[model samples]
Target chain A: MKILVCISKTPDTTAKIAFTDNNTKFDTNGVQWIINPYDEWYSLVRAIELKEADASTVIHLITVGIADAEPVIRKALALGGDEAIRVNTENSDAYYIAGQIAEIAKHGQYDLIFTGKETIDYNGSSIGGMIAEFLNIPYVALATKFELNASKAIITREIEGGEEICEVELPVVVSCQKGVAEQRIPNMRGIMAARTKPLKVTEPVAFESLTSIISFELPHAKAGVKLIPADQPEELARLLHEEAKAF
Target chain B: MPVLIFIDTAEGHVKKASLEAICYGAKIAEQLNTAAEGIVLSEVKDDLASLGKYGVTKIHHVNSVALNHLDAQVYIKVIAQIAETTRAKIIVFSNNADGKAIAPGLSVRLKAGLVSGAVTLPDTSKGFTLKKTVFSGKAFANVSVNTDKKIIALNPNAYKIETRDGVAEMIPFQAAVDDGKVKVTKVTKASGEIPLTEAEIVVSGGRGLKGPENWGMIEDLAKSLHAALACSRPVADAHWRPHNEHVGQTGIAIAPNLYIAIGISGAIQHLAGVNRSKTIVVINKDPEAPFFKAADYGIVGDAFEVVPKFTEAIKKLKGIA
Candidate 1:
């Protein structure tokens, strides 16, 4: 099966989120970046799993980012993907990115496309679905497990009060979630192989430009802690009603 | 022909998400000056006509046992066929699990402009622009639906259900049903008094309660408030609570109206899942802890010491103590 895994580079989870130029753009100064955790954990690893089960399988990882994203893209290639493509541009708007992906998927015509539910940076779970729309294929989001047969793939996902199991035909878009597969670390041999792997640099097809990032701001700060004596149950209750107005 | 809402049901009874979807679709249909129609999957116990209260004029029923369960591909195929047969301009989903799975699939099939996690009605002044939450509820974005066919997935608890006096006229539509390859094996359910996702009020605890033995306080507070019980990732990892009870970025994402956190220090991952909650109350002994900064109400105190008293007060206030 030909699988296309879309990936992104995001700020490391431990990075102190900050804004630059009077809260305009996310400040990258002193921030360490990594492959967005979802892409790393679910998408890349799952693709690797398929490749391991079938040596003929081709898992291509694609990213639309500036030149700086090459290292992370290389890391994803090292992790499991057989090849990598970097759409060398900073046009990261959901639409433009989705369009860029649609261009690749439309041209390549991969049998199966996989993405992590959302990027840790943008946290927009809308892209894979949008790409699916752009390509006009079936899409299943937040899939925990998958089983691909002759011409159909079965996806199991969690739902409210219970779980849901769905089956779709081949050539579908799927956004995987946590526990879809265990996180895998790159071995020395795989790391070495990744260095020589075919890394393709492609200019994205000209599309509608992105909407500007208006601004970025931190969330409003909550109130300071008001400690009540652990032993004083009455005092706590009184505070919930009289002051907090929560009760 | 207009707007089609997928009315979800279990054992033939309509789910709350379905009501929200109907209201959302009907309101959107009103915006477009088009009448709203619905498609019920299986043998819903509730009368399809009763859904008229939400302003749906028609309920297209294809009573089948096969559709009692969900298959995203099949639903996408069937809904697309239905949309094509009816010539629906816009399709709306609840942005719940089924919506998350099917909306995009349908979008792909229909080649429609799609937006998920929509919070408000579309801005119709120009081309159809939908506002959705971004950056874990910290920001909003306006996405334009540039395609001829448009698909939208509305978030639950984001839209209020509007009910009026009207009876939906039942219409049976002949749909081509296919038994897909997916089948249910064993369903391991979390048997709880309250499921975390559906709970309006949630009382969650972390290491602040100190140990598993002290969990009684959190449970008592949750019970007193008739709220669901949840824990942070650490607690679930430590096996202090079941895995299903964990709420965080890596766990379940919930946006309950009121979230009460006791002892949790507010990790960023944990906040990502719950930052959308309307009201947050944090109770911890450490006043300088990070969670206080995200809390609307903070009581700096030990969980074991303050929770029981807090529970007693609510009980007394409600005259249940």
Candidate 2:
């Protein structure tokens, strides 16, 4: 089986999300960049699990970014992928990025594709569905478990009220969510091998032009919490009804 | 120009998020001085005409037997074709399950400028700028669409639905609709009195409840107030609760009117999922728990003792024995 896992660069979870340039662009100042938590914790490890299940399986990693992202791509290889490819381009809005991924997927002709549910940076969960649409493949989002049986794949997704189990043919797209798997640290030997592994850097495939960012702003700070005395149930009731209006 | 809003339905009925989309499309239609029309697939239980009050000028029901279940690819094709036939310059969707899956697909096919998680109406004064959430509700961003046709996936509960007395004209749209390739042989819905997403009041428990055996207090409280029951990620991971009950950054994102958290430590991930709740009440024995920082009202007490008393108090207040 041929498996392709998609990864993106995002700010660490602890980074305070802020924008600069008069709120026109994200303020990456003092923010540490890392593989998106979703991709690292779920997609990459899950792909490694697939490789372990069958030693003959082939795994490749594709990213859409500049040469600066090469280290992260290498890190992914150290985690498990056999090779990696980077489409040298700066990250943009959902539309433009999906166009780049779809362009790559067209020629790669892989049987399975995986991406994180949404990037921690943009929080736009549009990539997997957009690529699936572009490739005309079956797509599932927020999958927790998958069981591949030759040509058929059984997948269960975390829906609003309960889990949704779906069965589909191969060449499917899945957006890995949390609880799929745990993150793994790359070992020394794998890291050394990753440095020598074939890392292909190519130009982007042209698609439609991108929509532009206008402005950004942080949410207003919330009010301080009010402590309702444990013994004053009547006061709590009155406060909830009169002041909070939360009945 | 016309507007086509895709209405998501389950068990042959409309979902709550669809109502908000109907309201949004109706208002946008009012702004454009055009009629707002809706496209509904098969198996809807609600009378299609009653939805007219939400500001639609027309209701288009495809009424296909083959379209009984949702297939993202099929819905994309159907909605895109409707836009072409109806000359819809703007298409609206509720950024819920169905919309999230299909809107991106439709955008790809039609090559329309697409924006998901739209929080407000577009700034039509200068082309079209849609406001949306970025970084998982930590910040907001505005995006501009230069394309002639725009597709917007409005976030659930982003815009309020206002109703007036006016009936929309019902028109059945004619397009070459193809059969769906995927089929849903069965729908095994969770048997619950209240669905967490649709509930106004949510009572959630974390690892504090101790075990699954002690979940009765949580259920009793939910039942007393007609609220939905929820849990934190740890509780679900521990197998004390179903994974569906888990609500956090990695779990379900919900925004109810009142969110009551019991015994939760309030990690940032968990808070990211539910900070939008209009009111939050936290009951924990630890006075310094991080959950209390975000809670609108904090009560320092044990859940076992406080919850039963709280339920009884609410029952007494409502005069329910």
Candidate 3:
């Protein structure tokens, strides 16, 4: 089985977000970058687990970004991607990135594809489903579990009220979330192997992006908290009713 | 072309988030000098005509057994046909679980530009510019969608629902349906009566509550508030609460109107999942707990004493037995 796992780079969770160039661009200064948690912890881990189960399974990692994103792709390889492919484009539009991924999938013809539910930076959650539509294949979003048997697979996807277990054949796409697999840290051996792994860079297929960011604004700073005395709990109720009006 | 909204339903009733989507679509239609219409794939038990109060002029119903569950592939086909039939210029959906699953595929099929997690109505003054939350609600970005046809998945609680007096005409639409490639095996339902995604108010607990045995106070507070229950990842990881109750970056992300967090230290991961909440109240014994930084209201007190008193106060306010 050949599986393609898509990864992306995002600012570390603790990074203080700021906009530069008169608030038109994200300020990367003094910010540390890491592989998006969803991609590294869920999607890529699940694909590696699948490959571990079957010795013949092959896992390839793909990303659409500039040279700065190569470290993130290498991290995925350390976690267990056999090879890496980077579509040399620095577009943040979800549609343009999905187009590039769909083009790569068409060339690879992999039996299964996995992508994180959404990147933490943009939080679009649109790429996997768009790719599935582009390829005309079955797509499952927020899949929490998967079990494979020959050419058929049983997948459990998170829904609003419950988890839906579905059966599907090969040549399927899944957007993975937590509970799909336990996160694995790369050991020294894996890191050494990743250093020598092949990472092929290709130019992006010509595609027009449909969306562009005009500007960014930070959320308003939180106001001074109203701290009701513990003894006056009834005052809390009054505040909730009249002030917050949350009820 | 009219504006179309996808009204998601569960247990034969229209979901509350979809009402917000209807209002959003209606406002967009009003801005564009058009009409707003809704399409439902499930068999709705609610009076479809009453939905006009939310500003929809017409509704299209296509009830089917297979439509009860969300099949993204099949929903794409059905919704694409409805959009074509109505000649929809803009399609709207609540950015919930189902909408997150369906809108992207539908966008690809319809060849429309799609924006998920849209927090406000599009600014058409200069093309279609949408404001959306990014970096897990830490910042907002205005995106310009340069497409003739557009798809928008509105954030669940971002827009308020407005009502006006009117009756919607129910229209029956027919289209060729397709059973998706995936087959259902079995479903495992979570135990909470109120789903976390749709809950307007959520009362969450943390390890500071100590153990599962001490969960009664948390449940009492949640009951009094009529809110769903949630827990930090540590509590869920330790099996003090079910995994379904977990809300964090790796758990279920919720955007409720009010989120009352009890005893949680407010890890960045936990905040990422719920920072979108309209109002946040944090209760913890330690004054230095990180949650207080993001909370609208903070109470430094012991949960054991504070929760019961708050519950009693709420019960007295509501006069509930």
Calculate DockQ per candidate and list them. 0.36, 0.55, 0.75
Model 3 chain A: lowest-lDDT 10 consecutive positions:
A224-233
Worst 10 residues of 3 chain B by lDDT: B184-193
Give all candidates' CA lDDT scores: 0.78, 0.81, 0.89
Predictions ranked by DockQ, top down? 3, 2, 1
lDDT tens readout by residue for model 1, B181-272: 44555444455556676677899999877788988878888988888889998898788886667887767777777789999999888887
Interface RMSDs of all predictions? 3.7, 2.2, 1.3
Instruction: Estimate, for each residue in A1-247, the C-alpha lDDT of model 2 and write its tens digit.
Output: 8888998988776677777889998888998888887888898898899889988888889899998788788888888889998989987777788888888888888888999988876667888888989898877777777768797777777554556777778888888876677768999998999989999888987766546778998877769788876765455545655687766
Provide the lowest-lDDT 10-residue window in model 1 chain A.
A209-218
Give the per-residue lDDT digits (tens) of candidate 2, residues B139-166.
7889898788888999877788888776
In candidate 1 the C-alpha lDDT for residue A98 amounts to 80
Could you give the candidate ranking by lDDT, starting with the highest? 3, 2, 1
Residue pairs with clashing backbones, model 2? B12-B45
**Candidate with best DockQ:** 3
- Clash pairs for candidate 1: A136-B108, A226-B300, A227-B300, A230-B305, A233-B309, B1-B86, B12-B44, B12-B45
> In terms of lDDT, which candidate is strongest?
3
TM-score, candidate number 2 = 0.94
Give the poorly placed runs of model 1, Cα more than 4 Å off: A1-3, A14-32, A49-58, A88-112, A127-139, A146-155, A165-173, A185-192, A203-247, B210-214
Task: Report the backbone clash tally of model 2.
Answer: 1
Q: Give a tens-digit lDDT track for model 3, residues A65-149.
A: 9999988888889889889999999866888898999999998979999989888888898999999998989898988887899
Indicate whether candidate 1 or candidate 3 has the larger lDDT: 3
